[model samples]
Target: MYYGKIIGGVLGLLVLGPIGLILGLIVGHLFDNGLMQTLKFASPQNIARIKQSFFETTFLLSGYLAKADGHISRQEVDHTEAVIAQMGLNAEQRKRAIELFKRGSAADFQPEPAISAFMEICRGQRQLCQTLLFFLISLALADHKIEAAERQALQRLATGLGFNAAQLEQMLRMAQAQGHFHGSSGFEAQPGTRLEDAYTALGVDPDVDDKTLKRAYRKLMSENHPDKLIARGVPEDMIKLATERSQEIQAAYEMIKKSRE
Candidate 1:
């Protein structure tokens, strides 16, 4: 049976606590269920609109998340630069991204409008919404310091993006687990990769049955498959991110499989 809902439901519990260990599994679950077959953006114009909105909202909310802790830190700035680099954006795109980021970081910037617009555009597309939430969560945790203010901001963003607090927590955990599984090579475990993180990366409990574990692994892989994401209207730039995420899931599953054997 498909395990996406099972994984997401379990991970949702983590958003209720700090160091959320439940995020990725839920997102993986939501996307792997073939729900995206209903996508309506088949026209070039529609696809372009989705891409533009997705890109703009991403940087805007990323800026909002960065400025959540009162002041934007150098690490956050560097992280944003790294994200831009990974996207390999052209000069015009980079400029627009920078401009949106600056606007979002302004003291009076309101994220509701952008969030609402994105929500409306992606009305039936849970995968796209979750992916955007995933990106913002990554930016929020970039500094490795999730202050109370930042945490609240994250919750707000989650709610604004049509997710509940539990779902936000799940996404947070999944994002954190990615750090453990991804490095310069994109899928290499960092030094001292922990078993706990491996489990978290897959959004499963340590004591999960082998059958369930395999289902969770398959669910995540199917969810993050690049072609699947593209069909769901995820920006092309995010395909690399999704591919790397799949790598992390695979690495995590491998770790679990080895330990069991």
Candidate 2:
């Protein structure tokens, strides 16, 4: 059996008793079947390097997106600060992140180098790459709308991250759908949550069969599993985002299931 299976099973059992073990095993199976990329870093030093790279690329690309529409708006700057605050960075880390953001926003800065460096560090881990893109997408939508230039820059970054146009669009839709769950304490549909948003959240058409819908939900849950993300080199602090993603997925699935029933 894959190490993912064993570790997932053990963690599940420890965290949630019996039911969590079954869920963890299922996720581990997905990991073994190629849903998650193989971990490349074997040493503490390499792990630290990977974490640093992830942090640097995140702020750098965020700055690039913020400046894509010519001038970075005050709203964008505030949003970026909010994101940094949510990360709960220490004094030194926050300082470094702000510096990276400024460097990326400089008129002479080119996003290609940062994108390439991040890609190399990610080693083709699709889920990790998606997580990165999700952060950028969230930033792009922070102003409540995506500008043409911002969209264009996002597309370029997506291509560099090994996603095609279609995949990026799918992620975009899912990200937008996720917005419905923001600022809410619970996962259930808040008042005014549209059914269409739920469908988009799953990245599926309403006409899709029950089995297909369930499959999409499962795939999303597996892809955003917090434990899997952390094991794959995502910083522990950042796992909160992934956990929120899982909640959104669950809420969307519940809404869709209720509608069909």
Candidate 3:
């Protein structure tokens, strides 16, 4: 049996909070089942563990979101494949991601259980949690519009992960902009079409001061930096997502700068 969901479902951890309780249960269960003999969670390995949880769970939830509309569309499949290509996963890693995705797409899959573990891994890093949400939102909007089922599912996930409705709506719109911007590969901008989206993507405003705008730009870039994300335990394959996010941030920043100039 796949122990990922089993530990994710450990009921006791929910009452204990994010750090020791959840991870303790996970490591203990793994050791008890002879999955691993020794466990060391000092910085490096700990970060890797969190990263693995985040990465694997992202794919799992991606599958769930895609299947929310009852059936996964060809568009959704293509989008997922495109992302897999971008991540450049090795054969084994790719297989694992695919399996996780499939598990998430199952009809009986319950998100609440795994989500508990996800929340724990993301306990202190609000930005990281929000960043993960953004990527999931992007996946939801891959087919252009968010279906009713998809929207409802997202609301549950967002609420569980500590995002408000407004935050989810805002990210949904930005992810829509991201789809268009990335689809065009930065070459096809209709005049004035992306103005508002550009600002929203950078979390800034057209009227913002130079310093404020620059600060937002730098902070977003730093947060989504590929190397930083990799160090945080994001798999090498997911670096493409980081790179794309940076490109969008840069594109949005440049558009605003030109308007100001």
Each prediction's Cα RMSD? 13.7, 10.4, 11.2
Q: Please list the C-alpha lDDT of all candidates, in the order they appear.
A: 0.81, 0.85, 0.76
lDDT of 2 by residue, 15-124 (tens): 99999999899988888766333333545566666777888998898888899999999889988888788889899989999999998888888888887887787676
lDDT, ranked from best to worst: 2, 1, 3
Worst 10 residues of 1 by lDDT: 16-25
lDDT of 1 by residue, 1-261 (tens): 346655665576566542233565556566764554344456566767777788899999888888888999998999899888998999999999999999998999999999999877766477888888877877777777688999998888888877998878887887788678877766767899889898998888899999999999998888888887787678898687777778888888888888999
Residue 45 displacement (Å), model 1 = 2.3
Return the top candidate by lDDT: 2
After superposition, the stretches of candidate 1 with alpha carbons farther than 4 Å from their true spots are 1-41
lDDT of predicted model 1: 0.81
Model 1 quality (TM-score)? 0.81
Candidate number that wins on lDDT, 1 or 3:
1
Q: How well is each residue in 1-261 modelled by candidate 3, as lDDT tens digits?
A: 446435654644675666646675676576555543223332676777778888888888888989998999888888888888887878998898899999999999988777789777645357667767877887887777888999999998788778989988877776666454454546333455568778877776668899998998899889888777776566666777878878877777777888887
What's the TM-score of each model vs. the native? 0.81, 0.81, 0.78
Error of 1 at 74 (Å): 0.9
Tell me the spans in candidate 2 whose CA falls farther than 4 Å from its real position. Answer: 1-43, 184-186
